[model samples]
Target: MVSNMAGGQPPWHGTEPDAPLGALEVYAEQAHGYLGASGDQLGKLAGLLRPPVLESWLRSLRGRVDPMDALDDRGLRGADLRRYLQAHPIAALMPLIDKLLVEDTAATGLMVVVADQFGRVLSVQGNDERVAAAAEVGLRAGDDLSERRIGTNAIGLVVRTGRAAWIHGPEHFLYRMRQITGAAAPVHDPDGRLVGVLMIAGGVRVARPEILALVKATATAAEMDLLLTAMRPGQRDAARRDAGRPQPAARLGLDVLGLGQPQLSIADRRIPLSQRQAEILLLLAEHPEGLGADHLALLLDDSDLDNGTIRAAMSRLRAVVGPAVFGSRPYRLHVPVATDVEALRAALDSGDVDSALRLHAGPVLPRSTAPGIIDIRDELRVRLRIAVLKSGDPGVLRRWTSGAEGRDDAAAWTAYRATADPETALYAQIEAKIRVLDRRMGADATRMQRFGA
Candidate 1:
């Protein structure tokens, strides 16, 4: 609790159980009850809470976070937290934070929280009592406070929008958090990429307008310090090293599906790859155990392809992505790589045919006939086809029969004919298309028989 606010507490302020609730807190409580209430209840939130808070509340609801439930979600700990902190660029800025935010807040009994870009609490500092109170509710170092877990909060809001935010009193989504107030700001590096968030919090301080401003200013100073550190000749190497590695900020995804040239996505940037490079990446993604150059060469081609060619390709691929993502000896991805194929499979597994179909572009790589790629392409094609056939939904069937991959698939058309109303003109169209395909196949067979030398 904020035992002391420097100046006297406002008339509306209430920390004890006996004290009357602040007007804003009372309204905020009403807003919480309105969650899942009909129409204007959602609309009415705008009149009650700030736009940011309302938006965050809606987002938290969508993420399936229950407002009344408190989370003890402390996953980032032990060796993992240590490694993450060591690799994180913000670890070097700790001294500056201590001087600027931590030391000054010592008297206020306000806790200073530093969260990584993903909203995992890295450190929590304050008076011993305040620190102990924070830990009891799992707001300790290594605990996840991201929207994905604890939902609407100051640190999570900053993480989501890359902007400063403040949540006061009942503005917090979790019931246990209503007694606290927080203001958080995004802390970025020299390149303007968000590395983490800096936050300050205390007992339900309802009207501390200066908190947001102070956090933002501190964040700006931290960014400037990062710039200065990068500018220094002696510290430049460290900065460069951090730049080469993926920060807690960057979101990585590999786009290998569809007919468009395959691309590797690093945060917002997409780096297009050569067909061979894409093929190599796809194969590597499939085989997480790591493939030797010789084995990878074979998967890339049916016949003998030299290992030196694979090494050269790997080198080029490493340069395109960062060298940090790759590992030698057997050659594998060091980081978790999410792909479009995996997304499709996830949707299918969850019975979300609509999303799965929407996600399906063309084949995994329509033009690629590399031995391993062919197997993968056929497997995905079969999986999608089977899913479409099983789902007797006419909309799904029509969608399948309409796509370039599914157009030639007779089985899909047959399934469509079985499920769809035969009275429609679409049924006649399918009949004609199927006949044409059959005749074409027959003619190809005749040609093959004639050419049997």
Candidate 2:
């Protein structure tokens, strides 16, 4: 049996004067009763479960997760899984993990499971029999072991809490996982950010307090290996120099153009942004001088919202994009953000019509309904259209007139008519389109006059 050398009292105490095993059994029973009972009964039975475990259980309850639900094994597989492993920062630690845990515990019916920061298991290794047994419950690679999917467990808890966690049989919130026990520790990159989780899991027979320490030590060693690998012979000098100087903040690429959802990319990691956050970021990007909370609220919504609401939203955004990128005082980006809209504007300002046409993906945040976003979108559209119409290049005018944005634009058709060869069929097409637009405008003007009368 593994000794409890970490110096904390065990999670449970038996009511019947029995040994540790019997006490654990009684504790498990009480925990189950507590979970099944109403919120009022939790206070009375709180002592039966560890503080961390109780907190996890409460979160699970809030999420409306069922304790008896089967584990969800949904994630990248085959070529996608291989590609993910190759690009993941934790890939370098796989050899060390295999050496320390997989090889050592293979014959002992123990499995070493490694998961990304999101609690998606990337790899699982051990003895054939044990590995197969673990797979029966969906503990293999490409499975989501997050608390939201599988209820409270060591892997999910470590990812959520960013600390070492231990969960033995009966302590697990899931009835199906009651026969298993596990210890998990968060793996960190050289900069001390959580990169993944390293866990050693097995049947209850092999469960021991010492497993937590083992997993912690292994994770630390793997991190050291990764740090050294990053500072190889050629990069040692540069890495040392970089370490001495303050590192530059990472850049965020915001793509708000077109009808598709806006995407935010930082360090090659791309994530989709909600329309509200996209609008806020776009406005902030436009006004580098920054805007106060009241102005931001006015731009974001017509309804009245206090500064606190905006502050809370900014806080949540900072958590995702990092504080270095999203700044507070007046509300502006601290780090440089490159947006497609800005790129197109720059190309146009430089009088590079060809480059500007190439850069313009579509209207900026076309589907956005925010008042500020609408204003900026219209301004950009008008500026680009005017710039293209003023350019005398037949090729540039032809490209613009053919696209959806310029198809019905009267100015674009007029520019095409002035630039295209009179003998060409393309010139006839442009003339026909101009006549159609003229008729549409005349009908609209007549309807407006009738309405006024």
Candidate 3:
């Protein structure tokens, strides 16, 4: 592919994993330097916004359009570009462009043009002495390359084909393109859709391997910038949209069964139950098959509460908690009732990330006066944490802890982990004790909100 350039073969059709186009070496070196100096700061920002916003910002500032027309095309302003680029400058690309021009005397007569997805040039760079004659045609960056302008050049053709193209000398399809060489490549979004093009247009003799390679490399880095930004909001919204399809109601007995902690209202009737009465109703609700004393004891967290005590609890609970406390048959919790676990899951599956996170007010289980329900609560909270992570909204965590008046070290550590930053892990280890304290406090908070404390 390298040797066939003069005879009209396309520069190697596409990139090889290890061997990037030659000019790419300079850009790659710059990328490494930038990453090292800032720990990939731009990459971090890219991870927080959408692709379109990041790419448009880069083209105007780093690409350096004369009047910032690309920014205009992208619905951005010159001032905004100035401030954003100041904050997130493309340090690597700028000097690399300078080096490419200075190294090749023949190429010094050339210029580089960077364009957006629509192919309007955002920047142009070339030595004044080398490009003296070519400047007459308004070929500087920020010009549109439609049929009315410098027609049929590499920039326009790449935009048209959505592929890399080389228009050397007279091969340019336009009558006005007699003096230069252009090697262009298309830039794509994270999804691999075309978003822009990068091209090096210069004197025909300098249309060498390095120039083509550099253009391709810059475009790739810029494309990476675009992709990382989309992960912030779009990724989560797309996921939610995909998961929002309706689901059939859960199986009756499998999902949940129990009288709520507060006696549930039924037909305006008020029923009061003794502790034993409520315990029996809860045990019956927990299992589809009526539970025997051994299994009931295990579920109730009262292995020592003898079957007789349970029998008495069941009787009193039935009288008030159910139809009648201890009325001949013991009270039973019903199948249709919603357990905390089931309620949380339903909210999440319905795409309510906020609601799901909110439901987890505390640790799953607290040290309980009633051990059986406490175990269930503990298990429920574990599930809620997982659901929050999968929900993909960092804000949800913030809202969940909004009411906390003090720092919750464990929660803070978890938030840091959710961000996947290295610093948070170290902090988490140093504050291990805080995890227990936070859990205790979170439990209290959740109980107050959910169970009226």
Give Cα-based local distance difference scores for all models.
0.74, 0.73, 0.46
Reference-based TM-score, model 3: 0.31
Model 1, range 1-453, lDDT digits (tens) per residue? 321124333233322222333645766777787876768767767655656777888888766677777555425566545545654667778898999999999788898999887677888999999988877765788776777567788888888898888777788888778777788889998778889999998875524767667777888889999888667774446436755444433334677788799987764457788998888877887787899988888888998889788888899887777777768889887765667776666456444565579899878888887899999988887778778878766778889879887776666666678765689888898878777766876756534422431
TM-score of each: 0.52, 0.51, 0.31
For candidate 3, give the lDDT: 0.46
* Model 3 per-residue lDDT tens digits across residues 6-80: 433222333321222342322222222332233345454243212322243234233222221221231223543
Deviation from truth (RMSD, Å), model 2: 22.0
lDDT of 1: 0.74
Encode model 2's per-residue lDDT on 125-181: one tens digit a residue: 888887777877767776667786577888989888888887777777787788777
Which stretches of model 2 miss by more than 4 angstroms?
Answer: 1-19, 236-453
